[model samples]
Target: MRLLMLGFNHRTAPLELREALAFDNERAAAALHELRQRYPASECALLSTCNRTEFYLARPIHDPPTIEHLRSFITQQTGADADAIHTASIHREQEEAATHLFRVSAGLDSMVLGEPQVLGQVKRAYELADGCGAVGPVLHRLFQGAITASKSVRRQTGIDQGRTSVSSVAVAFAKNIFDHFGDKTVLAIGAGEMIKASLASLRRENPKRLLLINRTQQRAIDLAKQLELTGTDHGGRAWDDMDSLLIEADIVVSCTGATEPIVTESRFKPLLKKRRGRPLFMLDLAVPRDLDPKIGSLRNVYLYNLDDLQQAVEATTSGRRELVNEAEALLRGHIDRCMGEIRHRDIGRLVKQLRQRLNDIAQEEQGRTAKKLASLNGQSTEQAVEDLIAQHNHRLVNKILHLPLSQLDRSDPDASMGFYAAALRRLFDLKDQPDMPMDEASSDT
Candidate 1:
């Protein structure tokens, strides 16, 4: 059996393409089953998130699927062409595939390095595939191992010690600014990536109210619905209602892509007067400054521009560089261990096949000898014949297993000995089988 991972990520594709290829739960599950139909021997799992869309498959295909196969599959599923899919990378064979999975699970491959969200997304993908019966023994083992490795890295390293992205940092800052988000009202000003990310972070605090206001009302409502699915107490209004929400909001994060400032001093001056000095934390995450710079000069207004938050993020990132290195080291060790087990399993399968072939011959000979001995049972010679047959069978067994036994002995000591041992049990139908007893199993190939 072999492992294959094919797909595109933020490194390869832009957000537009990634979003185009995004698969919801139902679609993802269906796509997995369809891929299995196209390659019946393959077990498949699809991972689709904001930053990437990847497919992990475990199969026995002698000529494994190529990048083109993946491209065609994606096109068929999402109606997108090859050109639309960027940075399409493929990993084949055991070691590379294992390493790739390890890195992904450890968050080393994430768009936002060390983000914890991807691990949960991967776990959910595996669960979805398993539920659809699209994951077999190989995939089941691979994903389970990946999940365990991720947990180990998190525990052993400081990769997740600090807030990394603007959204995460914003949420962390909010915690410091206010006692709790549960009682505060959050106003999301746009429906862009940053806004969505911030909303996700805000939801974690179990905020009492979330108001999404976007230039496009439908977009805002859609985001609201999505957040609601994640158990957020969310609602949405049009950009026209921004003034009304602003007066009531305790915290406001604006990430609009407007060419001019969306929230200028002129817009907030009146609201500030009406509110009479209620403290408001405003975060301008847009490139062009969604909130006017002068807004920071207002009384009781704690305004942070993108540069300020970015500086904080950079500081935190520098402090965690050592942790990233440690996490990577942990990931490498896990990859090595998982690959070793896979190699051992492969060898065991080969040994089992060889043993089964020999056992078939032994069974045939035993049947023939028993029939012939029945005819000669009229004489005491039957006892002599039985003893002779037993000796012959013993010699045949030794001769058949000679090569495997020898190879096992000469092979690397730490190499998967279980592979050959498992083969012996499976092929010979051995009851209460013992270890290959390296000395005996490796006598002579």
Candidate 2:
């Protein structure tokens, strides 16, 4: 079987396209079944996250699914034209697919390089696909190996030693501002995508109160409910009473898509007076920041724009470039190893076929000799015939294995052994047989 990985990621597509293609668990499972139906050779698993959407498949090499087939699958599931989105998608075959998956699982592919959450997300996606019965041996082995490789990379490299990115930097800034998040009241402004990611990061700190404040009351309520369901230690509250929520909030993180600032100095001046110099840590993650630039000038008000957090993140990432390079080289080595294993499996199959062919010939010759001896043989003649048949079988087996054995010894240890094994099998017309032990056949070589 040939392995395939096709999808779009943060590097290949913008958030707009990624969001359009994102699949929740139910949708992803349904899509997997649909892909299998559309391409009989495809044994598939769909992985969709905020940063990426990918499909891992194993199919017959002779009838491998085409780029057009993958495009159609995506178009049918997402209602986006394949022609328009195809440029954003990448196609990987066999070794490339394995390498891509390893990097993804290790979080090297993340927008925030080496972020830890992505590894968990990949594991969850694999589990969901496996539970849905959408995964077969090839995909199963590939994902499992990818997970192991990811763990190894993380353990061996310092790539994930620090927090970087707007959300993470915001959380770190919070820690610097407050002794404990559990004692601070958090007010989230707008239900933007980044806000959701920020909340996921913030929730880990077990904040005291997690409040959702959006222009739409329903959106705020929905976010509050989701945060609650995700088992956050914080008590979640909707911002139907926005004034009261704002007045009470100790920290505010805003990531709205508004063209202009949502919270000006004038808006917070009265609230700051009412709180009597109590510090308000405000993170304005919006590109055109949600908070007014003047807010930073207000007393007891700490307002940081996206640029500040971005600078911090960039500094951290720059320091870790060496680790990133090391991690990448490690990933490449793993890809090579996995490909070598796959090639070895193929060679083993070929060897088994060749051995079976010789066994068939030996059995046939022994049957013919026994039949001829049946009419005239004493016990000694029958025994002699059996010995002669055994000797011929040994010679035949030796001749068939000679070339493969030499190649196996001399060929690059990391190169595919399957090609030579397959050649031997095809030449000998050896059909694979059931109930044969691999070690016994391999030992003969």
Candidate 3:
């Protein structure tokens, strides 16, 4: 069997280029159907996510899909330029294909290293391929192996200690400080990517109230509406209300690209008193410091600046490097087990062919012997057929074993062929059977 994996990821292409080649659920199903029709012999699975698009293919060794075929199929489905797609693509074959899949499934190759969402995305893709009937023996084993490897890596490593991204780390830190999010109020500053990621993570926790304030009032309104948190007095407000907003908020995530500190200690000190000593967790994700550094030391106030977050990023980044080596060592063990299974399964086909060839030869010899017995002995047709059928069983076993016997006999005086003959006899269970030996039954043939 032949196996191939090809794809592009966040590292290999830009977002605009990735979007041009992305697939929705309906498109994914249609793409599989079209690929099956074009190459019926090949089993195919496609994994498309925000960060990557990967295709896994399996077929007979002689009928493997060419690189040109992959390029054409992608171009047809996504309308992406062939040359551009080629430039961004990564291709792997056989064992290397399985290795790449294992790494990706384990989230080692994610845009944000060790991100957990990728495993779920990959699982959904595998389920889709199974539903489409595109997963044959090779692909099925490959996916199962990848899943096992990923699970092992997660269980064995500390890669998921933090959420692995600045925004996600901010959410994790917030979660750690609060006992529950049911009554928490989150005031998000700036409507940018980091803020959006933090909002998405918070929404999963189901906070009581979410507020948005931005320099551009309309941008805040738009984000509030997008999050379905738009309301008269609760959702969107102008940046001028920062002092009043901080007094009511339990958590604040600021990601605006400001040149100077906006939330000074003097401006925030009065708000802390108004908060009645209630704890407030503030995350400063912006460059040039959105909040003053002195504000961090205030009573009932916990502020994590950009420098703090950077330290976290540096720790996780360095930690991931050490853990990745451990993960790869663990993955190799799983890959070896999968390769062993594939080798055993591949032998099944050859065994079937060998048996079928031997049966055909025995039937031909049976028919010839029956005709000769009828012509010379004047035997009835039924009697001749019954006699020949018994002989056919004997001939089948002998013919099946003829090659091993011949190889055993034509040997040098070194006696090496003796061991070969012993193995052949054991393989056919000739010693344990009730039937006479081929060498002893001289006239039976």
Q: Which prediction has the highest TM-score against the true structure? A: 2
lDDT of 1 at 189: 94
Candidate 3 lDDT at 63 equals 80
lDDT of 3 by residue, 5-114 (tens): 88987678655567677776678888988888888888888998756788989877888477678878999898888889999998998888888888898878765666
Task: Please give me the total number of clashing residue pairs in predicted model 3.
Answer: 0
- Cα lDDT computed for each candidate against the true fold: 0.77, 0.76, 0.79
RMSD of each: 11.2, 11.8, 12.5
lDDT of 2 by residue, 36-131 (tens): 777766678877765678988888777857767777878988887676678899989888888889999887877677877678878888998888
Q: Estimated TM-score per prediction?
A: 0.58, 0.60, 0.58
User: Which predicted model would earn the best lDDT?
Assistant: 3
> What lDDT tens digits, residue by residue, belong to model 1 across residues 291-359?
888999999888986556645665666666677788878888878877777667878987998779888
Model 1, C-alpha of 342: deviation from truth (Å): 2.8
Q: Which stretches of candidate 2 lie over 4 Å from their true place?
A: 171-185, 188-234, 238-316, 350-445
Which pairs clash in the backbone of model 2?
Answer: 347-418
